[model samples]
Target: MNARLVGSGSDTVVLAHGYGTDQSVWDKILPDLARHHRVLAFDWIFSGAVKDQDMFDPVKYSSLDAFADDLIALMEEVKPGPSVYINSEGYEGGFDISEVEQLLSSIESDFHSWASSFAPLGVDPNDPPSVTKFQNCLKRMRPETALSVAKLIFLGDQRDMLDKVTVPCTFVQTTNDFVVPNSVPGFMAKKIKGKSTVEVIEADGHFPQLTAHLQLLEVLRDVPGFDL
Candidate 1:
């Protein structure tokens, strides 16, 4: 796990990048976030930025729980004390089984081509640079690793685990995300046992940190525990 800590504060914020993205995705908002809190960002095992290709095992990491375990271990070693935890999960994650299968099939058939086609759809097409940035992130990943991780993310259902989340959570979402449906944040808010709220940034893509960094940062700063 390639992890790094930035800034200094009594609070800590861990930046966990979504699928097909690395720690670099947070670059736009990192400086502002670091001004108030220690931010920890890292690349996932499946990420292309990882130098050690052998670190990822398809069989062992067939579920999101394995990834969560890796994060927990990383946090333990890094000792990012008393951080505000942010996460999202649910059965209603905006994609049906058929949709997921189609996406996986597309990636399996030709990942590079799929990534080029998918990147614009995921990010705002108007922001050509951000779209290209995301596409490059996708293209950098090993095909096999990308396919396996895609399966794990699209197929896995973790609705039962929501009730176990007893800490406060702030779900930041974009107004028009191609990947995640609008209903997800509300569904997750209702399911989790903790006090939770959804902050919708008036942005037009899945990656607001790239396309709408200022708005994303404003929302983060307003989150209850992060106000400091």
Candidate 2:
């Protein structure tokens, strides 16, 4: 894990990138976040940007639990004490298993073609630069690795795990995220044991941090500890 610690403050913000993206996806909002808090961003083992490709073992990491374990270890190594926690799940995460399988099939059949088409669908097509940026990120990944991670993300469900979350959370979503259905954030809020709220960024696409950073920042600022 290539973990970086930036800025200085009483609170820390860990910026975890989504599928098909590396920590650089947070570039648009990181600076402003750093102004008031410490920000930790890292590339997961499967990311092409990670220097240690050997670290990812598909057999061992077939679920999000493995990834969560890695994150816990990374946080311990970087910051040994307690910190604010944020995280998720589904009543409808947007796609069903069949839909996810179709996506996986497309990637396995032709990753390059899939990335080209998927990137525009994942982000705002009007934002050509962001689309290209996301597409490049997707293209950089090893197809086998990408497919494995995709299965973990798209097919895996953690709804049973939501009740275990006890920390305050603010679930953020875009107004029009093609990948995640609008109901997801609210559904998660209901499932989690913690006090939770949903914040909607008025934007198009699944990646608000990339295409709607300013709005994303505003939403982040409204989070309890991040108000500073």
In terms of TM-score, which candidate is strongest? 1
Candidate 1 whole-model C-alpha lDDT, 0 to 1 = 0.85
Give Cα distance to truth, residue 117, candidate 2, Å: 0.5
Candidate 1: TM-score? Answer: 0.95
lDDT of 2 by residue, 1-228 (tens): 888989888778887887888888989888887887788888888888987777789998897778889998998889824455433222356887788789999999999999999999999999999999999988988999989988887776778888998988888888888888888888889989999999988899988888998887787778776654
Q: How well does model 2 score by local distance difference test?
A: 0.82
Estimate the TM-score of every prediction.
0.95, 0.94
Looking at model 1, report the run of 10 residues with the lowest lDDT sum: 85-94
Off by over 4 Å in 1: 86-91
C-alpha lDDT of residue 35 in model 1? 84
Candidate 2: where are CA atoms >4 Å away?
A: 80-82, 85-92
lDDT of 1 by residue, 66-133 (tens): 98899999998999898875432223567778888899999999999999999999899999999999
